[model samples]
Target: MKKILVTGATGQLGSSVIETLLKKMIESQISIITRIEEKRVQFQAKGFNAFRASYDDVVSLENAMEGVDTVLLISSGDQGDRMQEHRNVIDTAKKTGVKHIAYTSRCLNNRNTLANKLMVEHFETEDYILSTGLKYTIFRNILYMDAIPQFIGGNIALERGIFLPAADGKVSFALRSEIGEAMANVLLSEEIENKIYNFTSDKAYSFYDIATALTDLSGKTVKYTSVETNVFEGMMKQRNLPEPVILKIVDFITDIKHNQEAGIFNDLEIILGRKPSGLKNGLKTLFGL
Candidate 1:
């Protein structure tokens, strides 16, 4: 019996992964690792083996990995020092004698311009993980379709338009839940060392394409307005967004404009045994219309 432990167990992706796991295997084969005691208790109440562990604390992570055959090290949420936190988890996983590790990484291609500052950490982490000589599977996930409304701002529907600094770049976005489910499938499979999978939808869409979809679906006129990068930053600042966050958003939009996220891969379908969700349907579910 393989004992699989999932770190960051309370997060959106982690929780969805756990939901998929529960359907495929017994709860006794799964363990949840979370920093919050309340969340641990919540999982425990639902008949799961939950442990308290923080990526910042090596001892807690090692203790949590005890007797665990495979581990899902979901990337940390902290932006500033996430690489270090991931390092801790990887090192501790190696030290604790874990057999396999599956990591959630960002999708980055050969385009140098697409390599934003935040993406550098993922590359470095992948290099480090490969150096450890441990069996690892890296899932390079694309941007989530759920984030479209947020990226366009909250008033997209009301304003009947989408606004962004991004030019005409297309992104093959997948639902977070779908990606999580596929990842659960990977974790449950036989150990494959140093394999990389791109978790993205079959079709890609631009912001203008999204506006068209909205207009067609909602019976309302929606437009995609491309703004200058500086102007977009000013708009975010007017909304009282912090400087660091504003910069990150700007860089991400710039990457999109450069067509950084336009890759379509079939790995998702291979794992799920069906085609991943489409953009129009995903947007419909997101907008609740």
Candidate 2:
């Protein structure tokens, strides 16, 4: 039996991946590594082997990898020093003689002209993972449809407008749950190795499309307003968003404006064995109506 350890086990993606794994594999074959003791106890209560591991603590990570054959090294949430954290995980995994690593990364249409500074760490981490000479699978996930609500602000119905810096570029957003399921299936399979898979929806949607979907779903007139990057930053600041977060959002929108996330790929369908959910359906699910 394969002993698979998943990092970030309490996170949304990680939780969904575990849900999927529970159906495919026995509980004893799975382990979870989390920084929080409460989450570790929660998993343990459910009969899972859970460990306390922090990305900043190399010794904890090495101990977590003991007797584990495969690891799902989910990307760290911290944008500034996440690459270093990922390096710690990858290096420790290598030291422990782990067989395979499935890393989650961002989809870059063109790495050479990547406008999103937040994505630089992902590209760099991929390079570092490759350099370690370990068998790995890089899942280049696209923007999540689950994030549209946050991107447009929580109350889009009340706001009646979609404010963004993205000009008219389209993005292929996939459901986070579906992406998690596909990732779990990939981790359980043995066919793919040392390959990069683009996990994106087949259809792409611009902000205008998103606005239209919102209008139709909510039965209200919602419009997409394209603003300058500085203006967007000012609006975010007015909302009491932190400076670092505002900058990250601006960079991501700048990438969208440059059509850096417009690529549509079939890998998601190939992995899921079905067409990925459409944006309208995703929005409906997200809005819960």
Candidate 3:
């Protein structure tokens, strides 16, 4: 009767976690809380106790955690008040006697990325989670390797070339799917206890490395050019991107340029029990080249 609950069950990361769990455990042991009725029904079809809940709604969260022994609090996607939402989930979990809590948090030590509001919010949530004294696992996830296309503009990469404001910044990017599977394993392990884990690739890759990888994979000469921050901003603005989204993208590039995500950690290997693939392989899978 070991019940495990997964929040953000509809998102890419959450879906990965839930998908892996289904392979390892019975459906009765898993419950997914999502606000989308369509997604709720979809998960329900998979034999999960799929139901609706919101981070802002503590009552629903409490109900979701009624018999849940372990809960994975996927960081809320809300831009308005992510920290408060996280607090609500954590508080509700505690009140409902949920024993172990696992959270996907940002790299707290990355100074440059803190300029982004979401990064600051993640820090706040992490602090609150620790303060609550809940048996917790903090996964300080690095940039997802699967996100390279999104981050570096994959559409423009093969056609025009790679252009960004990142100045010699390298990241130990990881695969989101792999991370989700590893996290599921952590949730299932009886021996794993309260700990903070940094999930990342075994090595770091810079933008130049990305360009080279794409070139090799696609049989095209993709080039990386470091432009001024203003120039990059101007380009994004021309694309009719919203002001907030443009600013968020700029902050992400800046963080990479500052080498904020350049650490290779073995913590992921400990949970996964294997070395994650390098950048080129990830790029190939992402671009289908």
Full-model lDDT for every candidate: 0.85, 0.88, 0.86
lDDT of 3 by residue, 64-122 (tens): 89899988999987565777889899999999999889999865356434556567777
Rank by lDDT, descending?
Answer: 2, 3, 1
lDDT of 2 by residue, 161-278 (tens): 8889898988999999999999998988856578898999999999999999888888888999998888889988898999988888887888888888889999999999999999
Error of 3 at 207 (Å): 0.4
Cα distance off (Å), candidate 2, residue 82? 1.4
How many residue pairs clash in all the candidates, one count each?
Answer: 0, 0, 0
lDDT of 1 by residue, 206-234 (tens): 99889888887788888888989888888
Give the winner by lDDT: 1 or 3: 3
TM-score of each: 0.96, 0.96, 0.96
- Candidate 3: residue 2 lDDT (0-100): 76
Residue 47, candidate 3: how far off, in angstroms?
1.9
Which residue pairs clash within candidate 3? Answer: none
User: Positional deviation of 261 in candidate 3, in angstroms?
Assistant: 0.7
